[model samples]
Target: MGFATYQLDRTNIASALTGGFASAISVNQNTINLGNQLMFLGVIVLEIPSNVALQRIGPRRWISAQVFIFGVIAALQIFVRNRTGFLLTRSILGLAEAGYIPAAMYTLSTWYTKEALTKRIAVFFFGMFGGSAVSPLLGAGLLKLDGKGGLSGWQWIFLLEGIWSIVASILLISLLPERKLEAPEKTISSDEESVSKSEIWNKATSETISLRIVWKTLTNVYKWPHFLATACVFSTWSPLTTYTPSIIMALGFSRIKANALAAVGSLITLPVIVFFAWLSDTTCKRGLTVMLSIVCYLITLIVLRCLQPHVGKWSRVGLWTAVNGLAVGYHPIHNAWIQVNCKSPAERSIIVMSATAGLMAGTQIFRSDETAEFYPRGLLIMIILAICGLALVALQSCIYYVRNRSNSDSVEEV
Candidate 1:
């Protein structure tokens, strides 16, 4: 859904649309804020209904709708001028992109056995990695604005992707196989489905749960120390992803180089993610994996903040760019650890999604008051967030230590 019109580049978009004191393209903070609100609305639209609809209407139709939405979102870029239209279109993008990652993960999980799950997940997630790697090249190329038509570069970025997305939607509709009963991903044993069905019904019908299951489930996460720490650890992951371009820009690199390096960072992330995920499987320890990742992230932020001053001196700021790449695995490891350890599917589904959703608080914090300029405030917040994440795991380790000594059962240790 990032087949988007609202350009993230500061100089590019800022120069294109300016009406206020904020020199950033987000010149009108309120308008920018409103557009962001639309983006979040898009996130919610996907987060909630995507899985539910797959169960009812099926993936074939869902994928179709997804492509249709992205296509329209792409097509609409030419006409979109104000923040309202941007927000409205981004909302569509959210809904459209919502199905892809989860559905693909579920399918991979179903199709592969536990031993093979790692490879399967890697393959599925690799789609994101590969797509992200090429996205910048594609985006920049689309933005060249040199064809016979005199469209804005951003306009070409939108329109070309929209057409591609629609074609994909049709292919998905024609090719997907129908399913009589739905379970997780592509693999569902009938017996497992039968058992799962009862559990779902029981949970649904229970008064204590039904009264406010979502609220309860959300609160349930806070009650546990592991959940709390895990959430905190996960939340600080965005600095590298969201702020890296700005970080590199602060390094005083050219916008052309900065955008190009962003793609390189994504390519660098792929292996680090896979290596860490594979390591988690090998070690059978999620906490250590998370702890190590926290350290890497801490190093990344501190080094980045320190190096920002020296960037003009370095001459190789682009080379240091891979530091963000180094920390990328932290998230994939954390996520894979959660997926591997979460025993029951219901618990897995809710907790995993919540952990992911909760972590997005980082976005709010990262983007907050930075004006999408230098994220000094954002970096400070990230440093704090990273420390808290470390403390979370440390605290959990302490709790696990005491509880295990008292009960002689270490099974629950995260």
Candidate 2:
């Protein structure tokens, strides 16, 4: 629900802008894009620190607080009357949302083993993809209430979605579990049995991340490929999220219909994500599945770039749907691959947050001027980035394979 709420808030403006949002604020597409850039900037700057704070404060407390703050800020978007207000609210919202995903992922990592983590991570991301699928539909409905209570349709979208987030935060505080510090065993050791109940309670409630751990994570060379690969691939996905409705509207659909139809691709993506997760788990080949998903998306991009001009309207829609549907199919599998390679909880948290920061940085590829051309330059940039990402993934796999083989040879010699 938290993840979904974030998506809803993040994309609501994109959907609303097509209806009455731009006129309400007296802003143009460039102003909106600048606001988005500021939001991502805030997220990138605060991502690491937010995760570190999560470690010190505990997930239940810190994550819930973040969500509650996010909800408040999202709701406040309804009151923005001009460009300054829009940019300010977006930046603050990004700060509040910065670490929630990585913190939740870190919490999940503590509970699940590597072999079982991908499926669970996929399930968790259902909230995000589900929210993306639903946001436009909900926006379409709420947009009809344009004059209700004297608020614009976009205002209602922000207000109601923010309230939902606030409610989700309360539920999280009541139900989210603490970290599982140890695996289950058949019997307790005598020394463990001798520990006091007070000590056990304290251990369960408190966690501390040190500066040394942070420094180590910053300097880890092995993690850079994962971060870079995520940045490049995720950049390809940004324009779709922000422009899908407008793209569909250009096909001669009504604004509301465009919003509704934009959801088709995200709806199709849910099952595809699950299938990849299942394949990754069943085959025990994380890197292979990640690469395959990326290839699938790359194919769609190439076809869209090459054939979109000659295609009929509905055929164009189909192509766009395929592109959006396949956008993030590799994300969860890639996340699982990165998590299993990390050395500790602190390392995983840092690496995950850093990777997400890379993703935020990539969102800048799409610009206001390029939207008229259906982002030809953006599409070309995404294609280039996707190819770079594939190379990085392949190189990382080779690095790991060679390192593992060398270890095996050394053990055999010993």
Candidate 3:
């Protein structure tokens, strides 16, 4: 619920900001892009540190506090009269929201086995994507209150979503479970047993959040591929999330109708995400499943790029909806794969946080100017990045396969 409310505010504010808020504050496209970049910057800076704090203060307290602080900052956006105010509020909100996702993910990892983690993470992401799907719909309705209480439609959107976040934070404070570390389970394979014998793995049950642990996790060679792959693929999502409604509006729809229509793709995403999660768990092939999901997204991008000029507005809408629906289908599976490969809980915390920081780096990919040409340059960039990400995923999977086979051979020899 907390994540859902946060995502609702995050996405709802985007639609509102680009429409009514931009006009109200007299800010240009560059200002909007810069504000978003700065917000993501703040999140990148605080991601690891926030995870450290989560370890010290506990998930219930730390996460709830984060939710409440960001909610307040989001609500305060209603007062922004200029670009500086807008940028400042956005940065502060990012700081407040820094580690909520990773914190929640780490907490879930502590409770579930590797086999179960993908489905659980999918359910967790359902909250996020669910909020995303609902945001534009809610915004469409709230936009009708444009002149009520002397507040603009954008102001009403922010105010209501912010209030919902606050309420959800309070609920989280009462409901979130305290962290409880469990003993490591016995491994069935030689590769798994080898991991259990590692020095870091021995410390898997530790509750301490030491600087050394953090540094070690940061330097772990195994995690960099995951981080880089995440950055590459997630960068592509920035333009989609920020510009979809505007793009729909450009197709000759009214602002309210565009906002309402934007929800269709995200609504489609909910079931697609669930299906991919099931596929990953059922096949026990996380990498290949993620690759398949990415391929589906890449196909949409390719088709959209090729046929966009020839298609009618309705056909473009269908293509865009397909793109949005496939955008995040692989995310939960990738996260589970990362967690399953980590040797310790501390490592999971740091790597998860770092991977999310990579995602933050992606928010700057879609420039304001790119929208003029229907993002030909942006789409090309995303295609290239997706290919790079796909290659990395394949390489990492092969590496693991070879290493596991070698380990099994050595065990048989012994």
Better of 1 and 2 by TM-score: 2
User: What TM-score do all the candidates reach, one by one?
Assistant: 0.74, 0.90, 0.90
Point out where model 3 deviates above 4 Å.
113-115, 180-205, 409-414
Q: What lDDT tens digits, residue by residue, belong to model 2 across residues 216-242?
A: 877777567787898889877766877
Candidate 1 TM-score, C-alpha based: 0.74
- Candidate 2 minimal-lDDT segment of 10 residues: 197-206
lDDT of each: 0.53, 0.79, 0.78
Indicate the worst ten consecutive residues by lDDT in candidate 1. 2-11
- Ranking according to lDDT, highest score first: 2, 3, 1
Q: Is candidate 2 or candidate 3 better by lDDT?
A: 2
Query: Per-residue CA lDDT of candidate 3, range 244-291, in tens?
Result: 888888899987899888999999998898888788778978889989
* Clashing residue pairs in candidate 3 (N, C-alpha, C atoms within 3 angstroms): none
lDDT of 1 at 284: 72
Q: Candidate 1: lDDT of 267?
A: 75
User: lDDT of candidate 1 vs native?
Assistant: 0.53
